[model samples]
Target chain A: DTAVSQTPKYLVTQMGNDKSIKCEQNLGHDTMYWYKQDSKKFLKIMFSYNNKELIINETVPNRFSPKSPDKAHLNLHINSLELGDSAVYFCASSQEASGRTDTQYFGPGTRLTVL
Target chain B: AQSVAQPEDQVNVAEGNPLTVKCTYSVSGNPYLFWYVQYPNRGLQFLLKYITGDNLVKGSYGFEAEFNKSQTSFHLKKPSALVSDSALYFCAAKTGANNLFFGTGTRLTVIP
Candidate 1:
């Protein structure tokens, strides 16, 4: 059983196009997160949702929006994708939202290529 | 503010030799540190964490880390490295808000 999973493993789109990546976790976790890994392999958190409520919103651009329909799912939608958006997106989940000690599990990741 | 640093960009080791990947952290309050490993084309995998227990923490795949409060470091170590252990390693610090700050990853190459 995959604890965390992300759909559309690879996304290739033209500049200014819009795309969405889906994430789901069966770990029964209360918190979900989205992270971006740049070409240099620098990982940074973008957004987090706890029980379908926005909790952590980093200094990300407004073009990127995260939506959580339910506690088990979190999706990221990128509008006007630019070349800078070409990177890997990871989805993660934790057992609780308030526990700083809780371990997070990550999904396979979606590789986005904005041409 | 919370931050993690991995000084080494890459470390090469031979099979059967011990390996160490250094990590340091800076945070406001008590530091909650974590180690994650990533293979090519894969997501980050949890290796270990230091909350408030023993300074020496053991983790998956024969890995361990020592947490030093004075030094503000959590360095991952392995007694004997295997070629399969070659991968990218990351150190992270969790903040009071449950946000994680990751360091620039260190690539470990375990040569056969």
Candidate 2:
């Protein structure tokens, strides 16, 4: 079974358009994260939600907003996307426990292209 | 802040030869290091991790990593490279936080 999944594997849209990428996880994890990989293959964390609470917010622009409706879903909505926003976005989830660490299971990622 | 670095952009090896992918990290507290592999057109898959104890850690697909605290490095290694092992490998680290910082990935190409 797929542990973590993202919708719309590929998205091509014009500049200044708005788009949303959906992510869901069935691993019963409490922490979900979003990462953006640029053309240089530098993957950086954009945001993280633990149990539906915003935890880690990187230096991402306010144009990118992440909304977690519940523990199982975390959706990213970009407003006024720019040409520089073209990259692959990945969703990952992990369960956190005291004094124990877990590996993050990633989704198939959504490749976004802003023309 | 915590960060991970993968110096080599790409590492090439023969199918029968051994392989190594170097990774280094910087963190204030103890580090939680992990290695992940991403095949073409696929998501990143977990390979192994070093949370505590056992300086040398073994993972899936006959891969292993040595966590050198003195050098602050966690390098991935494989006994024998396979053509199917060609992929992008990433090193990540976390320090007392739920967020993981990933390094610029290193591409591994095993020549047959």
What DockQ values do the models have? 0.82, 0.66
For residues A1-115, write the lDDT of model 1, one tens digit per residue. 9999999999999999999999999999999999999999999999888864686565798999988888899999999999999999999999886887999999999999999
- CA lDDT, every prediction? 0.93, 0.90
- The digit string of per-residue lDDT tens for model 2 on B3-26 reads 798999999999999999999998
- Model 2 scores a C-alpha lDDT of 0.90
Task: After the best TM-score superposition of candidate 2, give how far the Cα of residue B77 lies from its true spot, in angstroms.
Answer: 0.5
Best by lDDT: 1
lDDT of 2 by residue, A24-93 (tens): 9999988888999998888888987776367656589999998888889999999999999999999998
The A-chain TM-scores of all the candidates are 0.95, 0.92
Task: Quote each prediction's TM-score.
Answer: 0.97, 0.95
Model 1 segments more than 4 A misplaced: A56-58
lDDT, model 1, position A58: 53
